[model samples]
Target: MWAELIQEVRVAQTGVQILFGFLLTVVFQPKYGRLADTDQAIYIVTVVMGACATGALVGPVSLHRLVSGHRVKPRAVRLASRMTLVGLALLLATMTSSLLLILRVATHDGYVPYLVTAVVAWYVLCWYALPLWARRRNRGGSGD
Candidate 1:
């Protein structure tokens, strides 16, 4: 379970790190200074969320390294799993905010919020709903 969790974290960590790195560069862009106050605020929030998501996704490796000699694999796995879940949720927020900022800057259409909301719903369905449904459905079977 620990190995599996680490493998999963590796995938998430790569994505969040890439996103955070990109977010770090946006402040240096020429258009950054021209953004509206509200848009700047959104950008700040998105970057912060990206940073946090990156940290959370990378936390498992750090946790393992620091506690390597200890006999706490089970507890560590539980904690790391929780951290990964939080990281994923933060990643979702970061992506949503990033999209919102991009859409707000690209076009001032009134339907942007609706479009973002729909995308969020789709993410929730894919990231959480389906997995949860499958977990519940298979709870009584031998899969566990």
Candidate 2:
């Protein structure tokens, strides 16, 4: 369980780290100042969300390191899993906000909100709904 959790965390951690890095750089770009006040606010929120997600995704590793040899692997794995879920949720928010800011700046169309909503719904379905459905469907099946 620990190994599997670590593997999953690695995938999420890499993504969040890259996203947070990019978000960090955006503030220094010249165009960042040209954004509207609302877009600037959105960018700020998105950057904060990215930072939080990166922290949550990296938490499992720190948890494991600190708890090593404490005979608490199972408990650590559960906590880490919870952190990963939280991280994923934050990542979704970050992505949505990033898209909203980009679309608003690029097109200024009335459909941007609807388009972002659709994309977010798709992400929720892919990232949460499908896995939840699978878990429920397989709950009574063979353990293997």
Candidate 3:
């Protein structure tokens, strides 16, 4: 369980690290200054979310390191799993906000919000719904 959790965290950690690194550089770009106040606010929120996601995704490794010698593998695995979930959620928010900001700046279309909504729904379905559905569908029959 711990190994599986670590693998999952590794994937999320890499993605969030890349995103946070990119977000950190955005502020120094000359075009950043030309953004409208609302866009600027969105950028700030997105950056913060990216930071949080990075931390949550990276937390499992730190947690494991600190608790390694305590003979608490089960507890550590549970906590790591929770952190990964939070990280994924934060990643979702960060992506949504980033998309919103990009679309708003690229094209001030009235359909921006609707499009973002559709994409978010798709993300939720892909990231969470399918796995949950699979679990529920196979729960009893597998006899694990």
TM agreement with the true structure for every prediction: 0.97, 0.96, 0.96
Worst 10 residues of 3 by lDDT: 135-144
Poorest lDDT segment (10 consecutive residues) of candidate 2: 135-144
- Candidate 2 at 46: error in angstroms? 0.5
Q: 24-96, model 1: which lDDT tens digit per residue?
A: 9999999999999999999999999998999899999999998888999989999999999999999999999
**Candidate 3 per-residue lDDT over residues 12-131, each given as its tens digit:** 888889888998998999999999999999999999999999999999999999999899999999999999999999999999999999899999989999999999999999999998
Per-residue CA lDDT of candidate 2, range 1-144, in tens?
Answer: 898988999998898898889889989999999989999999999999998999999999999999999999989999999999999999999999999998998998899999999999999999999999998999999853
Q: After superposition, how far is residue 81 of candidate 1 from its true place, in Å?
A: 0.5
Judged by lDDT, which candidate is best? Answer: 1
- Kindly report which residue stretches of model 2 are placed more than 4 angstroms away from their true locations once superposed: none
List the pairs of residues colliding in candidate 1: none
Off by over 4 Å in 1: none
